[model samples]
Target chain A: MENDKQKFRLLDTLYILMMIVPIVFGIVLKILTTPQSEGIAISGAKIFFTINLPIQNLPITESQIHSWLVMIAITGLCLFLTHGLKEKADTKRQHIAEWIVENAQKLVIDNMGDYFSGFAPFIAAILSLSAFSSLLALFGLYAPTSDVNVTAGWAILVFFLITYYKMKCGPVVYAKSFGEPVPFLAPLNIISEFATPVSMAFRHYGNVLSGSVISVLLAVGLQGLSSMVLGKLPGFLGEFPLFQIGIPAVLSIYFDVFSGVLQAYIFAMLTMLYVAGAFPADEYFRRKAKKSTI
Target chain B: MLELAIGIILGSCALGAGVAMIAGIGPGIGEGNAVAKACEAIGRQPECKGSVTTTMLMGCAVAETTGLYALVIAILLIFVAPGRLVDILMETIK
Candidate 1:
């Protein structure tokens, strides 16, 4: 009992120290480093490759690097977790793996119906990738979703799937569907069809980019406020950014954690719904009938 | 003349962004109404909460597309448009 109490106390101290050390380090770093006047630059990928022959520069951006990191981390985790799987699950890792797979299956089944069960892997991958990329911003990495290109890539894939499924119904039916209810609205129908991917990509990119912009502004603003408050103090003490720590963390919770998860979920949910909507109308009714009968 | 042009450009962009944000009011009211109805439904039948929430979120997402359109416009006006306008003014002055 005493040993357990000692262990708890040690952990509590370690946690407190862990929290405080970062703030102290950040404050010291702030004092040491000159702050830039301009906020974070909104720019494209930095070029990493140079060709000697034609003098071509191949650029790799922060988004690509961070996304690659996320992919590697996720792949490593999955491999590590599922390394030793037995018929009878014993370890915590196996249990977690099973739970994740089961929930993903359930999500796909619930949203897209049993007829689209094959889409489970794709949906799971998108959900995990989106969530991880968004959460990457919390660690001060450039979130891949902040780039419109990344989101557009995902949206284009979804667009292709939606179009392909609609085309599968019949080329005549597909072409004629655009003119249905009123022939005059055909142009509008076609525009709206194209608008799907654009809107999806823009929605996600805008949310994440706005969140990043706001947080950067907040941090800079906080630093300014801190310097003003601390500037009154004598000598070296005036240089410290006292207000930089703890305060912005409260806002970060909402901007980073909450919004990131929500946007990721919304993006995945929209993708699933758009794809499911492309399935034949009769299949939906049939599924509904089956569920009702069961 | 240059100062006036720059001022006008910045002012117009700000005004446009503000106007774009006005689209938020629609989604605000819509999502509120949706959640309120979902809550009422859940109150009437607690067992249907899962389906009710999912449907509510889906409806809310559809409703939010208009707001997102406004946001995209606002972002363009605030970030991209200003820079291009400034560049154009510089070229004109040159």
Candidate 2:
């Protein structure tokens, strides 16, 4: 309990920081990092992707690096802020927590070691790529993930990682994955594998791309409404000592914080699930569930 | 002609954004579920509340991704769009 409190203090603080930094830095990123990307003409000439924000583009230009930095920073700060005490945990509670953590670690190590030595690197790469892409988009940056090229790269890496891990885990059955129970299905399986990356890429790219688009539009709408309805004629009418800024503030809260963090986690987790599922490694949580049920 | 053209682009963008936000239903439901589960877990086992909360938050965050994407697409469609082509096409037709 004591140790848990200490750990929780740091982690909770980190979470709070994570929740807050983006609200501030998101605005900052918008002004600074928005990319100056030119799209290619059909004739193979350069045309730029029009991103209005400069800083948002920084994460994109730097790919995953810039995004990770902000994410890590926010996380670190949140931990710093939420620092708690080291109280003694009872044996039962300590054992349970330790068991959960250790089991998870063991599963990860076994899967990564016995199966794909590169599993850790592969997952990290995918996560970094996504984190950066999302942070860019969140901050109103023109992002590579905004473009299909970067997304495709993400898909390709994921596809390869899945295949390599699968092959190592079940070389025979994996080979059988192609030219499986029936010959015709072989082509279909290939397509499915191919589709894995494409769908995964689109899913991540589409979500970030769409979220960026909507928040900006909503923000614009709210700002326009505020300027038109409230700011105008307020002084002429007799400026009420009580002003209501709450309506737009509520809208801003939902658009900026709640949705942004969720999207980043989803993109990263899907990548994790896809990679982990490929190895056919039984997850610790699921094992725990089964054991508890028994 | 220009006014009509701009209106068309802007209108289409707005329409598209509205469509994108329709996907928000997913995350809204998922987050609620996570919260509910977290509450239940907390009640059942207060000791592991911290870890449970973390896990719940992570799950909720993942759930929010789809909605976020919809927002991004809608934004692009509205503000940062391919310009002039639509206007030119409208002009030629007119």
Candidate 3:
């Protein structure tokens, strides 16, 4: 018991250090480094720093930096949640962690069946990354999801997974399946197959980006309206954006918190559905039976 | 001539954005119908409320895609088209 306690303490220390180091390092880097981007970045994520390599210059943008921070934060949360987990679940953190894991596992099993239960972690990772990345917008940071490239990367990965699973039945069979009902529809099948990733990426990226864009437009409009309404006041108080205070908070709740989390859930759910649909139940069972026979 | 050309282009851009937003009506009606059906389903089987809500949300998100695409086009027209068009026209005239 004493040895176990010592081990727990060491792990706790490590977790704390792991959480602190990246954040501190990021802050130091941000303060010390001169921003390499020149000229006004009109829209989209602004380039923060450009690293000149022998191969090509890598321009790090706001989305990349903020995503890195979100990843670090997620890692820290995981560490904190799993820190000193006991078998009997004495602590609240342990219960929370167990509950989260149990629900995620159950969701995967329910959606994709028992055969694909292994996908729970992947789906959970997607859900957390999408959710937290979009949530970053609440803190006035550039959300990585708002940049179509990030969501496109995730969608493309999902598309590849779907394609790989579909091809497991054999590439010839898969290609033939595309022309089902009519060989003339082969081109349409190909287009639809390609459309999956594009649609998923655009759906997620557009929702988050539109939310932010609308918020900015509303804020600017509100400021102008407020100045027009309150301009009669004397001194500096006249220009104060009085009307901009409470109105935006109402919109923020819908645009940021609700829409961000909902989009994340939809994206993860769609990915699970598409991937599971790629491999039919009969094929899965046949493979399982074959393995069992061996 | 340049000022008049710029004005016409900007005005058309605004008009195009407004027209693009007409796509919003489809999703609005679709989601309303979806919610109404979901309400009926829940009323019939209250215990299935959780599943019904989830399905409704997923359907609504999918339905909203067309509206979102239109919004994106409208945003591009309003914010991007005017500037680019005006700039191109100025260069051509010069």
Candidate 4:
């Protein structure tokens, strides 16, 4: 207990130092550096750095770096939560872990039925990754989901899962399934199948991108307004954007917090629904029985 | 001549973007109707609030797709179309 207390005190001091050092450095740097002429430059994710490949240059973007950071943070969180686990819940981390897992399992079971309880972890992974990626915008980082390619990649994976599950009934049935109701509708059905992933990708990407775009626009407008109104004031207060402080936070609550988490939840729910629906009623039973027999 | 052409192109792009945003009206109305119905359903049977809210949210999100599509088009017009149009015009002029 004595050793643990000493270790925790050391960690506390380290944490405080880590938090304060960069902030102090940033303030000093800001004061020393010349003020930028440009008011606010709003644009898409910048290529942070590039790697020279054999065929082409691989550009690592702001979104990509932020995503890596988010992944690392999540991994660290998981490690922290699962460390020193016992048979019984002796710690708060263990209790929290159990709660998260149990809730995820319950969500899958409720939405996609008991057979899809296996998908709980997958759903949880998507939920966490998507939500965390979006939430990064709150910290003034470019969100991965704001990049169409990232969301497209996830939507494509979900699309493949949906198609794969649908094909489990048999190739013949899968092919014929498109021609249902009438032969004339086959092309439409095929187009709709393709549209599923496209819409999913665009929906998620557009939401996050629009949020960031609007936020930037609002900040720029507010800054301009503030400058117009208070540019004559003495000292740093004149240059500083007073109006840009609290109002943008209100919009950020909706765009960054609510919309981000809501979209993540909706994406997960849609994935579950589409994948579960892909299985024919008879196929679901057959698969269940097969698993039981095995 | 080049300046006039550039102005014309940019003005058209802005106009197109504004026109595309009219698509938002449909989604706004549709979502309002959905919420109203959901509210009635909840009022009738408050016990099923969980499922009702879930279904309403799903429907609203799906309904918002058209508006989002329009938003994407508008964004493309505002940000992308002008540059491409100017480039093509430049090439043609050259």
Candidate 5:
């Protein structure tokens, strides 16, 4: 028992040392490299390609590259997880695969009702993509959701699905929905329909981008604060970024992890709700009415 | 004159951002209400906590959309519009 206690204490000390060493190194590097006067500049994604065509130059941005990386990573992980299958319930991989599939199915069925449960895979894919893309910012990658275009793309797809499902009820009914309760309200209804995609896209994009901007500002501000406090010290000690180590990590938990996960879930949930709402409610209501009359 | 125009632009941008952030009050109140109700529901029936929480979060996110729209506009006003306005002002003066 005594031996175990000593071993645990040594391990705990080693773990703390491991964490502290890198942070101290990072602080030294940051102080040595960064100029005091320059505030951190928040800018859009860097363009990697400018294909010179006769008409226009098509530029591929950092967000596009990062999204591709995220896609490849998810695909590779899925492939690795599902490489082998067996009748016997044995492997951990199989357990995880089953759990994921089961939860996805349940999420769609529960949120979208029984009729629209066919959309489970699609919803799962969007949720995974959005979550992964948003979380990528934690690793210093340009998050795809930070770019409006990426979120717009997803929103547009959801918009198309909603319209398609709505039209499936009947073209006349779909068109008449714009008028809603009164004919004069048609323009307002139409505008609200258009606003759906715009709002969805902007919400995700703004949340992720704002979180990133705040994180950057906080880091720069902390560095400035450290310099103000530490500059009184003699020589090399004055240059140390004393405040930069543990403080930003706490903020990062909220900005990167919480916001990233929440925004992704919100986007997916909104898409599911909107798409499910577009489905015809006539049959369900008619059945309920018949039951009541009986 | 240029300096005065610049000051006006900066001042208006700051005011616009503040005004835009005021939209946050609605969502704050709405989400707070939602959470309060959800908490009450959970307190009454602990078994339904998961579903209640999910529903509450969904409603809160929807409520947040209006604030987010305002935030986008505020960000544009503060960051993008001011720079362009100053450029246009300089051109006009020239």
Candidate 6:
């Protein structure tokens, strides 16, 4: 473990840059470009980039372009940085793939106590992507995690996967897993199943959007105090922070690291739980147990 | 005008960012809790380390996302402060 720690790698640097550089760039940029009058400048459509899908008037602007330039540059640089680096993406991905295939199945059997190894990657990817997106938002770019479509798409896909997993666990028993009493409640069970994806998607996106909005408000509001004191100094000197490293730093600790990961976990955990619930009981004792419980 | 206006943009960006960073609070507590729980689990069931570790890490990664978003916002605020420059421009006009 110590040897592994000692072996400094590009991904580490890449991740650090991913974490630090963007904020630095954004801070420097924001300080340089912030305007006083919000009315006129804030208006008009700002377009960043366009794809096949049309967004009537995009929210992108020249400043946003410059902002994204820094972001894209870092991401692009990461690719180059990792290229031919000791730990190549391809190698790590391949090794991960192999490891997951080899150990994941056995581990699932041992721990999860049932089958379904094929879908583990999907779970991992969605969970990680959500986490990464929230982290990316810290740099001021619109977070993919905050996008309802992105999250909803993921949730719906997960729903189908769970259904598939349920089918695979036991075809005859799959339908029986739901609406156990009588048969009229089948629609209610189906609706409840449908509710899973909606909750799954909204849970993540809402958390991110609320965090983004609230934080923006608080940080914006903090300036209100400074603004009140502006030009109030004896010689019209600017108001200096009480302590350069205290309150804001504390705030940083709270917002930048904690909420980001929690929401991601919540999103993924809910999906997994829903999936786990879909599994049929392994009834080895009775032939009648194979029949539909519904 | 442009340069001074540009400078204040960083303030708003920082504000936005500082706000963004608030989300980190949840994750910090969460990851700590997760680590503690994982340690407890390891002590309780050493044989289940692999599964426990994997699950814990995966959960931790998810918990970390909110912080990431805030970090991004904070970065954008501190580094770019796009609105800061806009303020400078307003100052010049004033």
Which CAPRI tier for candidate 2?
A: incorrect
lDDT of 2 by residue, A1-294 (tens): 899778876776667667666556645654564446532111111232444676664223443434445556545543443344235544454555455445544544554454444444445444544554455544544554555556767678767878876775357757766886797888888887887776666666665555544555655565555556656564654333222345544643454344444544555556666676776455444655787999
User: DockQ: which candidate is best?
Assistant: 4
Q: Please write out the lDDT profile of model 4 over residues A137-161, one tens digit for every residue.
A: 7766668899888889999999999
lDDT tens per residue, model 1, A132-172? 88887676656788888889999999999999888765687
Each candidate structure's TM-score, on Cα atoms with residue i matched to residue i, is 0.81, 0.50, 0.87, 0.88, 0.85, 0.51
Error of 5 at B73 (Å): 1.2
Per-residue lDDT tens digits for candidate 3, residues A160-212, read 99999898877886888798789999999999999999889989998998888
Error of 4 at A128 (Å): 0.3
Instruction: Give the best candidate by TM-score.
Output: 4
Worst 10 residues of 4 chain B by lDDT: B58-67
- Kindly report the docking quality category of candidate 3: medium
Model 2's DockQ score: 0.21
Candidates ranked by lDDT: 3, 4, 5, 1, 6, 2
In model 3, the clashing pairs are none
The interface RMSD for candidate 1 is: 1.7
What's chain A's TM-score in each predicted model? 0.79, 0.51, 0.86, 0.84, 0.82, 0.61
Prediction 3: B-chain TM-score: 0.98
The window of 10 residues in a row where model 6 chain A has the poorest summed lDDT is A39-48
Chain B vs. true chain B: TM-score for each candidate?
Answer: 0.93, 0.81, 0.98, 0.99, 0.94, 0.71
Q: What digit string (tens of lDDT, one per residue) describes model 5 on residues A104-184? A: 999999889988878988988999999988877776667889999999999999999999988875688789788779999
Name the weakest run of 10 consecutive residues (lDDT summed) in model 2 chain A. Answer: A39-48
lDDT of 4 at B35: 100
- CAPRI-style quality class for the chain A–B interface of candidate 4: high
Error of 4 at B59 (Å): 1.4
Residue-by-residue lDDT tens digits, candidate 3, B1-94: 7678888999999999999999999999999999999999999999999999999999999999899889878978987899899889979988
Off by over 4 Å in 5: A1-39, A53-56, A281-294
